[model samples]
Target: MRLIQQLIHQAVPDLNGRTFERRSARGIIVDGTKILLIYTERYNDYSFPGGGVAENEDLIVGLHRELAEETGASRTKVLQEFGYIDEYRPHHKPEYDLIHMESYFYVCEVDCDFENVQPEDYEIANGSYPVWIDIAEAIQHNRKVMANQEPSMGFSIARETIVLELVERELLGKASAV
Candidate 1:
């Protein structure tokens, strides 16, 4: 997969340790002028509808699982992939030091017969919920997030912001190249 983007921690210095690798699958669901997104007030940001791939789990299967768990989109179809994003950051904990996350992104469509979201404990606690926002609104929200003092899950926020811009340019018929 191509590296669509990379997000690195700004204030945190890069550690001189071996980078731990984590792989995940994400979905991009767009409908007309709005797009499906997962919002986390704890982080004050939005992300694509997807999650981490479990041990020995196939990427495709993991994607379906994540979509169901995160958005409850049962009647869904996976379209073409946009690409992958690489995010490198210092581990939230001290011992791990450097951590690199490779997230695979795909274009997906969902039908009307979708189920309720089954969010994780952290998500429920942190108010992670779904929303369909106008593309313009999403772009503006992303910009606001970028200008904030400190973003929770800064890597995810920064990368999502970039992806939203790219999506807007392509789908909205914007001439600006990503």
Candidate 2:
């Protein structure tokens, strides 16, 4: 295994004994009435602002780093962990025959200045375009644009899980109703 892979496996051994590998983390950054999303060509969906956890990096720290790297917003704060989603991709990485990844999701908060946030060039090339959408609209867009067969497949559940919970908790207020 590569050095980073070894370190990551060690860090998230919960994935041990599984058929596939890799663990990642993401955040649902809600700034007022707008939730931060990333447009990705790979997934062909609008999704949250987070990414994989680097070797030996703390999950929360990775969330912050990915948020900033992808969304250009460094001051965001994690409010609570929402849940985890599992995805199986046959050709995600050519090196591996298959990729089974578990992505941890968190609900986060950022100031209202996210409207002008910019995605990094590398991220953009990787198909990430930062956009803010109302929570309900985001959920609909995610369902419509995602590549999942089942409503719960891939990162689909994690996509709307946090938002639904937050809405139930009244964090999203009236915007939660769309």
Candidate 3:
């Protein structure tokens, strides 16, 4: 997959010390101007419908699992790779100094009818739920959350916003002509 961007959180200390590496996969499912996303009420922001890949698990398999778990999506067919985002941030776990995350994104298609949605416990506590929202609206909402520095905002908002813009430009053909 291509590298879309690398982001270092402002709080990350400038050190090349111990780090924990994590790999995640996210899906981009679009229908006209709307996109399938996970809306976390606590954060008041949206994210892709996927999560961390388990050890030695195939990226696509993990993506499918995450899709089903988070959004009850089925019959998902991956169209193509949509690049990735590399991010570095302070780790919440004391075992690591920082966390280096590589998030892989793929363009995909899924059944319109969702069922049996079963998000992880933490996700449920966070009030995360699947939603189909306009791409521009999601982008604008995320940008606002970021601008206001919302206390409940999750770490993925910036990455999600950037990816949403890329989707708008490349997939939706909504980019401004220069």
Candidate 4:
């Protein structure tokens, strides 16, 4: 996959520090101008429907698993690789000083009908739920959250917002032009 962007958080001092590397797969499922996203009530922002890929999991497999688990999405077909975001930030776990996260995004198609969603405990606590929202609306909502710097805001907000903008410009833009 191509590299979309590389972000270094304010908390990350240097690249030479000890870090825990994590790889994630994010799905960009678009239907017209609407995009499937996870809205976290606690954070008041929207993000893609995907998560961390297990160490032994293939990226595509991870993407499917995450989509099913988070959004109850079925019959998902990856249309193409969108891109990825490389991010370095402070590790929440005490075992590592920093975290290097590579979030791979794929453009996908999924069945309209959804089943039971099984978001992780933390996600549930954060009031995370799936929804198909207008892409522009999601982007605006995230920008508002970031601008306010709300106490409940999560670290992924910036990354999610940037990717949403890219999707709007690259995917939606092309589609509209056609």
The C-alpha TM-scores of every prediction are 0.88, 0.64, 0.95, 0.94
lDDT of 3 by residue, 1-178 (tens): 8999999999987748789888999999999999999999989999999999987999999999998888887678999999999999989988889989999999999874556788889998989999999999889889889999999988889999999999999999997222
C-alpha lDDT of all candidate models, in order: 0.78, 0.60, 0.90, 0.90
Q: Which stretches of candidate 2 lie over 4 Å from their true place?
A: 1-20, 41-44, 111-122, 146-178
lDDT of 2 by residue, 127-164 (tens): 66777776677666555544355433444344344444
lDDT at 22, model 3: 88
lDDT-better candidate, 3 vs 4: 3
Q: For this target, which candidate reaches the highest lDDT against the unseen true structure?
A: 3
lDDT of 4 by residue, 1-178 (tens): 7999999999888987678999999999998999999999998999999999998899999999998898887678999999999999998888889989999999999873555788899998989999999988898889888889899988999999889999999998832221
**TM-score (C-alpha, index-matched) for candidate 2:** 0.64
> Predictions ranked by TM-score, top down?
3, 4, 1, 2
Query: How many clashing residue pairs appear in each of the predictions shown?
Result: 0, 0, 0, 0
Question: Judged by TM-score, which candidate is best?
Answer: 3
Runs of candidate 1 exceeding 4 Å displacement: 112-115, 150-153, 175-178
Which run of 10 residues does model 3 get worst, by summed lDDT? Answer: 111-120
TM-score of candidate 1 on Cα atoms, chains taken together: 0.88
Ranking by lDDT: 3, 4, 1, 2
Clashes of 1: 0
**Root-mean-square deviation (CA) per prediction:** 2.5, 7.9, 1.8, 2.8
lDDT of 2: 0.60
Q: What 10-residue stretch in candidate 1 is worst by lDDT?
A: 169-178
